[model samples]
Target chain A: MKFGVLRFPGSCDDVDALLAARRVGDAELLWHGERDLKGADAIVVPGGFSYGDYLRAGSIARFSPVMESVIAFAGDGGLVLGICNGFQVLCEAKLLPGALLPNSNLRFTFRQVELEVVQEQTAFTCACGLDGPSPVVLSIPAKHSWGRYYADEQTLADMEGRGQVLLRYAPGHNFNGSSNDIAGVSNERGNVFGLMPHPEHAVDELTGSKDGLCIFASMCLAVEAARV
Target chain B: MKARVLIRPKAGILDPQGEAVQRALPALGFEGVANVHVGRMVELTVEDASQIEPMCQKLLANPLVEDYEIVLDT
Candidate 1:
């Protein structure tokens, strides 16, 4: 499967994402504002200070020309994954369900975070299927001043009821003060996934952990599943 | 026409950046600063004021976590 990693002006993790995608399979980096999705089977928006986080985390980046194509690509059933800053962009663009606010601590927390796979049906989490309800142990670094995720009670309930809550910080251990401890979520279709953790950072054991491989691999499967 | 857009986080949502600014107010020599709220200021030149709504909806503010006000400068 061909993977397209977006490279915005200030995107810090574009290379990391490219490397991770390369490890998983064939991949290429697509510069932001290029006005095209390049026919990528799947697209990954990596984390970074796109537009220097001027207006908000992802607020400014959403207007980039690349997003227009990304939106169209996602609308046509192409798999899309947004990590950290990318998550913020997806929310800003209304491609995903909720918004990411400041972490409750109001501080940037960077460490090995544990994420529970709330729903494995999304193309993003199809690989990590642990038996029963135990949360999956994946080590990924997150660095953002506004990483808190928020949604109204009713909307939150609906997302949960519909199995759209794709991932969350481990129970009782949410690093960022996200409502419902949600770490990630997908739309009703489950084709688009957004999460706060940096899955690209975890794809290689040389950098840190290798638990993120499943997520990228899962996206490939998700694309193929949609085709079938 | 010139317009100013004020974007603030929605009520009940946490604002860590605002909190940081609030904490620094006293250190900056403001004793009466009991509260500090932060928002964005975007200046735009539009042909007609009607474009403000769509601009705010599309880029200025996220309806899910923030509310925005557009003021036209006469």
Candidate 2:
């Protein structure tokens, strides 16, 4: 499988994401202004300040030429993973549900956080390697300012019922005041996933933890599953 | 035509910036202040009045988390 990592002008983590994807498969960087996805099996929207965070984080980036293609690609059941600012972009583009609000404390926060795999059946997390008890937890680095996830009670309940809620902050690890401790969510189809944590930054244990590799590994299975 | 769009966090949605400002006011010895909310306003000129709503719905604001009101200048 080949992965395509997107690079907006202000994208600081594109290189890191590109390297992380390379660990799993061949990967290349796709420009935000370009219309081609370069025949990638999966698309990774890496985290960083895109379009200077103008209007709102991810708001302007949603309208980029590449995102238009991405929307169509996702609509066709292609695999897409959005991290941090990429998550915000997905929300703005309406490819994912809910909105990422400012942190309750109104400060930028970056630290190690614990996330519970909520929906392991989804394509993005099917190979989490969770063989034990319920609420499987993974330790990964999370870095963001506007990471607070908000969805109304009705919407949250619906998402939960449909297994659209993919990841939750374990115990007291809701660092951004996200509603219901939501760390990540997926589209109803489960093919597109978005999370605020920097999984790309967690691929190596020398820095922090290797638990994030579970997610990317799962994507490998997802691609195989889609083929069959 | 000239228009102003006001965007605010919908009622019941948490406004972190507003809360921080509200907390700072009390520290400055000001009391009796309540329900302080912070919002943004965008001023633009359009060729037609009909363009205001579409602009707000499409780009000026995010309908999911914010409520927008349009005011037209006479």
Candidate 3:
């Protein structure tokens, strides 16, 4: 499975995401201005201060030429994963259900967090068989100020009913004060996924936890299955 | 025509920045404050006033997290 990691002008974690994707399969960098996805099986929108976080996080980057392609790619049931600021971009593009607001404490924060896989059937978390009967929890790092997940009560209910929610902070680990402890979510169709946490940063066991690979490995299997 | 777009946090939405500002006001001796909410204003001159509303919906604000008002040169 080949993964394409997008790089906007101020994308600080683009390379890290690319390196993490390479752990599972072939991966390369795709510029924000890219018109074509270069035949990547899956797309990863990496985290960063894209467009210098001007106006709002991911608002400007959402208009990038590459996103047009990403939108079309996602519309076709292709696998797409957005991490950190990329999740913000997906929200701005209306690819995801809710918008991420500022952290409740109004402070930028980053730390290792415990996230539970709320939905195991989605393409993003199907490989998360982490020695659990059900409801697998993984240790990952989450960062940024605008990571508070928010949706109206009705929308939240609809998403919950549809199993669109993919991950949630485990109990007290709701660091950003996300709605319903939601740390990650997928679109209604389940092909597009977004997470406020940095799974890429957690790929190396030397750094602390290798739990992120399960998510990436999940995507690899998704792409592989699609090609079959 | 000159128009201003008033974009405010939607009612029932959490505004941490506004809450922080409100909390700090009492310490500075500015009491009797209530509903201290902050918002953004966008100024523009357009040929047609009708287009301004569309602009606000498309770019000036995020509908899910914010509410925007259009005023003619307010």
- DockQ per candidate, 2 decimals: 0.66, 0.87, 0.83
TM-score of 1: 0.89
Q: Judged by DockQ cut-offs, is candidate 3 incorrect, acceptable, medium or high?
A: high
What TM-score does chain B get in every candidate?
0.86, 0.90, 0.92
Clashing pairs in 2: none
Question: How are the candidates ranked when ordered by lDDT, highest leading?
Answer: 3, 2, 1
Models sorted by DockQ, best on top: 2, 3, 1
Question: Is 2 or 3 the stronger prediction by DockQ?
Answer: 2
- State in Å the error of residue B64, model 2: 1.0
Clash pairs, model 1 backbone = none
Per-model TM-score on C-alpha atoms: 0.89, 0.96, 0.96
Candidate 1 Cα outliers beyond 4 Å, as residue runs: A130-135, A226-228, B16-36, B44-47
Candidate 2 on A1-228: residue-level lDDT in tens?
Answer: 888999998999999888888887889999999999999999999899999999999999999999999999999999999999999999999999999999887889888999999888877787775565666788899888899999889999999999899999988889799999999999998889999998889889898787787788788888977789
Q: How many pairs of residues collide in each model?
A: 0, 0, 0
DockQ for candidate 1, C-alpha atoms: 0.66
Chain A only: list TM-scores of all candidates: 0.94, 0.97, 0.97
Instruction: State the DockQ, from 0 to 1, for candidate 2.
Output: 0.87
Fnat per candidate, as a fraction, reads 0.93, 0.87, 0.80
lDDT of 3: 0.90
